[model samples]
Target: MQSISSQTSKPEWLSSNLLLQPFLWAMSWLDYILAPLQNLIGYKRMAYFFVLPNLLIFGIFILIPMLLNFYYGFTGGDSILLENRPVVGAANFEKIFSCQDFFKPNTCAEDLFWRGAWNTLTFVVFQVAFIILMSLITALALNRDVRGRGFFRAIFFYPVLLSPVVVALIWKWILQYQNGLLNAFLVSLGLTKVPWLLDANWAQFWVIAVSVWAQMGFFTLILLAGLQGIPKEMYEAASMDGANKWRSFWNVTLPLLMPTMTVVLVLALIRAVQVFDQVFVLTNGGPGTATLYIVQYIYRTAFEFRNYGMAAAASLVLAVVLLILTIGQLLFQRRQEAA
Candidate 1:
């Protein structure tokens, strides 16, 4: 018994790790620091104190940058310094909007900007649709009782863990013109080598497809959580009432999942609008600017063209569009809750 117990017990160093002692001692000071503040604020209000650090970080990073961007939009100059920039009023915005025909980008003073805008619109519509549809399908499949279900879930989610740049690079190697795996496979099957990234339409298609493949996993996990939250008893009840599987899913599961679906939809929309990294690494807005998105346009305007004011104006426009979408989502969620 003594030998067995000795074998099962953790080693002394493992049981009380010396490496953690300093960290633990430092963390213990939090009690001294927070106790006085908690007493002054009262226990109920102490929640704010715990949350203060996050609010400070947000203010320092996100909120401040956004306010600065907004200010920079009204100023114009080649200089990056705000003081050197002259207040240009609405000239930057006017430049962006100075198109004769709204439908024709060639009529615009900033034709590239218009092109990027139209490309972004197309990307958002297609990417969001695919992401939502694929995510829901994968979530439903994973929620079922099947062999190796855990492995399948992990396989689907593994792509989400990869960096966007890394994902793009991997796909770039696979889609290369000369020695790409995809091209080789096509040749083996008696098909000619196709220019996946060099062409306009193919580049657009692949960027959207690759983005959908990378991000679908995260939304799938959200949907899976929603699916699991639904009570099994509802299915049982429906079964007793002679309802088919399709009927039970259509009536019960769909309604319960709508809230989660709305959250996923809005998140996907916002993410789709801000897409840049993967597409940048994959296409670099090449093939005659076919895949040049709004974010890329802003980036080039600020850095490449040295047009800080125009970049800031474009940034503000993008922010306004996102804000509208977010507001719409909130209102929809409010109505959903009310009903």
Candidate 2:
């Protein structure tokens, strides 16, 4: 057994392996080409060579699309092709913002767009709040010296591994009005059946709840890492000064965890603003567009209505909002660090 293990571990065995030979050959060829270039540019500048491939990919996939989307926002027509479209200036923006009462979406010319914006804002505010609170609590609980800690952690994080659509489908099955698992259980217990999806308010509530459940694991993991990175000596010092657990947590833990908490908040806010898949699968922005969000609005405008220009305009507006939020978060982080 020892001899067999030794033979398998040898470089000669690796070289002879069919599966790895192509990759090995490619690497050897790449190294051969890079050797001369490395000498010309020096080792320090060779970092650019390693980064060039990724930069090119990013430019092609991300940067080009963004520029096209921005340019498309200024044009109007039913056509998907950019070259044939006529530039309509800010007509799309004017249509969107040409509202008598900004608070009342019905007053807007593009009422559904405004409705989606309102719903997205509402969702982001509540979702971010609940996600932050729940994640913090869960992280604190998991970080403690508890029994079956690994099992509990795995259970909490398991949902995060599932795709968004899968998560939505699972929840939909559990929350269905007539034949859902929850409704069945309620019937068995002689309780009233709750209209989870049919009603507007209830639909919004369930969407937010399921979203929080599906995503809490990731934020909790981030918070747990932040908690672990904190210095134990600070807690010890607080204890020596006659501080209780709550006091120590407030003073030491919260302050130290602020940076990680900010990251979680920003990411959660962005995701909430861009929410689509779960809402689409679970509710389809239904019950009179009550749960409709901005991304869904953009999608419908482009594909369903075939108003590509309007979709592009709405997308640019969404991008600007996100960019502003990101810039604000960065400025706040810098101020915190300076302090």
Best TM-score among the predictions, by candidate number? 2
TM-score of each: 0.88, 0.89
Clashing pairs in 2: none
Task: Determine which window of 10 residues in candidate 1 has minimal summed lDDT.
Answer: 9-18
lDDT per residue for candidate 2 within 1-339, as digits (tens), equals: 988886776676565769688988899999999999999999999999899999999999999999999778889999888888999999998998999999999899999999999999999999999999999999999999999998998899899898889999999999988889999999999998998998999999988999999999999999999999999999999999999999999999999999999999999998899999989999999888999999999999999999988899999999999999899899989998999
Candidate 1 residue-wise lDDT, 22-89, digit = tens: 87888888889978987898999988887889999999999998899977899999899988999989
lDDT at 55, model 2: 95
Give the lDDT of residue 173 in candidate 1. 99
Runs in model 2 lying further than 4 Å from the true structure: 1-22, 32-52
